[model samples]
Target: MTEPLVVEFEVDAPRGHAFDTWTARCGLWWPKSHTVSGDPAAITFQPRPGGRIFERAADGTEHDWGEVLDWEPPGRLRYLWHLFFDRSEATEVEITFTEQGGRTLVRIEQTGWDRLGEAGPPRRDKTRQAWTAIGEQFRRACQ
Candidate 1:
């Protein structure tokens, strides 16, 4: 097994605002390049454990991305991220929000690639790239 991928973003917003940018306002900054549809009507999180993180098509089709495992607002979120994979192939993603001098530090830690066997490393690499780009967009949006 390999180490979990960790990526961090420093945003110029309060903890609550930063967290909300990732959760409530994600649709505002989520890029088409990172979406399943390439052009989704919306990206949504259900705001609680067991709630779905998904995308909706213009025609109202819901594409499942993951299930929220932990949903502590302004501080933490953990979820099972399947994205294009089956639920059996899902990986875990944990995110934390910490405040420093009024700025919020958002950390994303993705694990469980071992379950994917050979496909694990490449997928991790790709997700890491995606998150890196997304983090920049998120950071700008938080501004």
Candidate 2:
């Protein structure tokens, strides 16, 4: 089995507020172009346990992209990512928001990847880069 890919960042925002912003309104900060549909406007996340992280296309198509495994407001969220290209391959992701003074310390830990084989490393690296970029974008958006 492949090891997990972890990524973290500290944002200049309150932990509670940051957590709300990330889960309650992911589309606002998530890069829509990064989605499978390649449409940013379609991205959506429901910030509740058993909720969905999905996309709604112009054609009125709602494509489920992930499932919320755990939802604790202003603290942490764990989800299952079942991407389209490989429906059999699933992964778990957890994002935590910790308060430090006034800033929010965000940490994203992802694991449960064993299906990609030699492609796993590259995929993990890609996820790391993508999450890093997304975190940066979120910071900029909140600025």
TM-scores, each model vs. reference: 0.96, 0.88
TM-score of 2: 0.88
- Pairs that collide, model 2: 32-40
Q: Write candidate 2's Cα lDDT for 1-143 as tens digits.
A: 77889888898989888887786667778786777666645566786788888887777778788889899878888988876645456688998999999998898999876776777778888888888899998886655
Model 2 misplaced regions, further than 4 Å: none
What TM-score does structure 1 among the candidates reach? 0.96
Instruction: Tell me how far the alpha carbon of residue 59 in candidate 2 is from the true structure, in angstroms, after superposition.
Output: 3.0
Please list the residue runs of candidate 1 whose C-alpha ends up more than 4 Å from where it truly belongs after superposition: none
lDDT, candidate 1, 30-117, per-residue tens: 9887778888999999999999999998989999999999999989999999987899999999999999999999999999999999
Q: How far in Å is the alpha carbon of 121 misplaced in model 2?
A: 1.6
